[model samples]
Structures are given as C-alpha cells and as structure tokens.
Target: MEADLEHYLEPGVGLLQDNASGCAWKNAAGKKISCAARETEALVSDLMVDQPLLWLLVSFSVGILLGKRLFRGN
Candidate 1:
C-alpha cells in the first residue's frame, strides 16, 4: 500500500495550484465550526454510488482479511 516518493511533485508548483482559502466549514475570524464529518460522509457515499464495483471488491477483500485474522487458529 505504500507509494513510492521519488516521483512525487511539489504541490501547487505547476498547473495544479491550490487555492488560498481553506475548507468552507472553517472560520477565519470568529468562533470555529465545522461540518467535516458530514462532508466526509457525503464524499464517501458519492464515491460508493459512483463506483459500486470498486467498493464491492474492497469490501470483499476486507471481509476476507477479517475472517482470516479471526479464525486463524481454528
């Protein structure tokens, strides 16, 4: 799962520059509030809906790993 770092680019150095503003849920001058958890849930749900097959395969792999770990002594 580890990725090679030799070919990594410095972020915001080329055409893919990042915006100066932070996530919309952050407060720059007032009391801090966040919807990060809800936003993350929505993002994951969107990904699952968009790629059902990928999610299915990932879930199957996780289930197999858990089963092996839990029943390894049997």
Candidate 2:
C-alpha cells in the first residue's frame, strides 16, 4: 500500500492469510517472477492448454491401447 514493501516484509507478519491468492509483478532481465503456492490442477490445465492437439492424441492413443488390451481376450 506504500511506496516501499517494508510493511509487507515485516517480521512475524503474514503476507497472505486465510488461503488468499496473491501475485507480485516484477521486471528483470532473465529473472523469474515469484509466485504464491503452486497448484497441481492449474499446472495440468496449463499443460493441456499449451498443446491441446498433442494431449488429445496422447490420451486417445492411451485409451485405444487400454481398450485393445482389455478387449483382446474377450
């Protein structure tokens, strides 16, 4: 809330309470922006969205492989 982030970094104080989501926007060459706790669901969705067709093909292949195996002896 101020020019400096001193209060946010104060000792014995929590930045995010009650499981709130927060983000820090920074600009630095070759420096990654820090983030809050990671979420598996978000990461997976990102992966799927990154290469939708590829993931679709992969899942379809697996499904066909499983179906063949399961129905082969039937």
Candidate 3:
C-alpha cells in the first residue's frame, strides 16, 4: 500500500527501493544519533497523546482566517 501511495505522490521521483532496511537517526548537525525506529515512533505517539483537539481546531481556524485576510485584502 505504501508503495502505491509513494508512486502516486511522487510520480517523477523514484520509488523507495525494497533493499531499504533500518532507519537512520540524524542529529541537529545531520549526524547519526544511534536512535531506533521504535524510539521515534514512541516519541511521536507521546506527542499526539498530549496534543488537544481544541488546539488543532484553533490552529486551523487561525490559519484559514489569516489566509483569507491576506488574500482578500480586507
């Protein structure tokens, strides 16, 4: 499924090779940090768990309002 999505999303771009294996951990300087994929997924899960629905709604509303104001010139 991921292969199909990648093909449609990046038509000109090359597909992700099946030879790919483990994930690389990059640091602030783009250096390998020795982090694992499981650790990254856990961190992302923790962040999503902490975020509130109201915050997302407010952010989306503000983005749309600002975009309209900027483009509509009023």
Candidate 4:
C-alpha cells in the first residue's frame, strides 16, 4: 500500500521510509525527529480517539488543499 501511494506522489513530497523496524517520528513543524513513528502515531490516535468525526473533517480538508497544490499543472 505504501509503495503504491509513493508511486503516485511526485518526488520530494514528504514520504518517509523507516530504516528500522520502528516507525519514524517528526516534529511539530513536520520535520522528522529521532522518535519512533509508531509511537507518535499511537499518541495522535489516542488524542483523537474521542473526536473521530472532527479528525475526518480536518483530514479531508487538508487532503483537498494539499492535493490541489501537489497535482496542479505547471
């Protein structure tokens, strides 16, 4: 699934490949940090556990905005 997604994405569009068994982490500014990615994903998943609807809306909005810019024609 990850490979399929990467194939469609343009180069340098924020894909991170974990070099180890653990997932990679990133800072608040979206910069990759030295933390485990699964840990961060778990933390975030826990934080939004009570707001699944809100999370869906926000994710959808952000995806639309990002898709517009990333797939826009030159």
For residues 18-43, could you state the per-residue lDDT of candidate 4 as single tens digits?
A: 43433444234244443567679888
RMSD of 2: 11.5
Q: All models: lDDT?
A: 0.68, 0.64, 0.64, 0.71
> Tens-digit lDDT track for model 1 on 1-74?
11464247564543333444554444543333236666788999998889899999999999999999999996
lDDT-best of 3 and 4: 4
- How badly does each model clash, as a count of residue pairs? 0, 0, 0, 2
Which candidate wins on TM-score?
A: 1
- Candidate 1 regions exceeding 4 Å error are 1-33
Model 4 ranges with Cα > 4 A deviation: 1-47
TM-score for model 3?
0.29
Q: Is candidate 1 or candidate 2 better by lDDT?
A: 1
What residue pairs clash in candidate 1, if any at all? none
- Ranked by TM-score from best down, the candidates are 1, 2, 4, 3
Listed in order, each prediction's TM-score against the native is 0.46, 0.40, 0.29, 0.36
